[model samples]
Target: MEKLDHIDLAILKTLQENGRISNADLADRIGLSASSCSRRLDILEKSGVISGYHARVSHKALDYKMIVIVHISLSGQFAKTLAEFEAAVKRVPNVLVCYLMSGEYDYILRIACKDLEDYERIHRDWLSALPHVVKINSSFALREIIDRPNLAASLGS
Candidate 1:
């Protein structure tokens, strides 16, 4: 990947603010011709800098009222054990994000569900059954202070 120029940074910053912005509008904002902007955008996508566009949907609107932070300690840190755990966690419906961490816990997961009852069902049916899991600690979020889905823009700025 080539080093991004000022124009490239401007394009990224603008796109991060509004992913749905039309190419013509984006060009106008970034002081470039539509053709030039389109070319740069194409390069950004092709080079995997701009991975993909997505809608930021509300979890509340989807009836997911609770976010559970789960810390999991695995029985073993072997490759096979980690892989098996990851594969199983991917299949779990309520699991929003799973991270393999270098801490006391082997893995940490962010889960979304309707309520306590819903989370209980998910825990009983899926989370507890995950491979190599020796310890599971769960914490319920009372409120969300802030959730930034756009961090790449900060880098450009």
Candidate 2:
């Protein structure tokens, strides 16, 4: 990971806002020549700083109307148990994100579903069937307040 200089930071900030921005436009916005901007962008991509570009889509647009936050407590924290749990979670299609936590809960999952009935089905069929799970607590998100995929704030402006 190379240290980000001023130009690199500016490039990252601009790209974060609009990944589809043309190279020439990006260069103009950041006060860099097109060739210089292209080189820097190439370096950024090669170094894994600019992982990939993507279109942000609303879950609701895809018929997923509910977001559920689930906290899972495992009966044990053995390596095999954790591995099995993680692998099993990956097989579940509606589990958007899963994290191993350090506190009271063993794992936290963000799940998307169509409705309460769909969530109930997931809870009964998938979450409960996971190995080593002792308890599962779930809460529905009323609404999404903020969801930013950019890390521009870490660059210190």
Best by TM-score: 1
Can you give the TM-score per candidate against the true fold?
0.95, 0.93
Candidate 2 structure quality by residue, lDDT tens digits, 11-125: 9998888889999999999999999999999999999988898998989999999999999999899999999999999998999999999999999999999999999999999
Model 2, position 58, has a per-residue lDDT of 86
lDDT of all predictions: 0.93, 0.93
Off by over 4 Å in 1: none
What does candidate 1's lDDT look like per residue over 1-157, in tens digits? 7998888888888888899999999999999999999999999999998999998889899999999999999999999999999999999998989999997999999999999999999999999999999999999999999887767678744
Question: Candidate 1 — what's its lDDT?
Answer: 0.93
The residue-level lDDT of candidate 1 at 129 comes to 99
**Stretches of model 2 off by over 4 angstroms after superposition:** 153-157
TM-score of candidate 1 on Cα atoms, chains taken together: 0.95
Candidate 2 C-alpha RMSD relative to the actual structure:
1.5
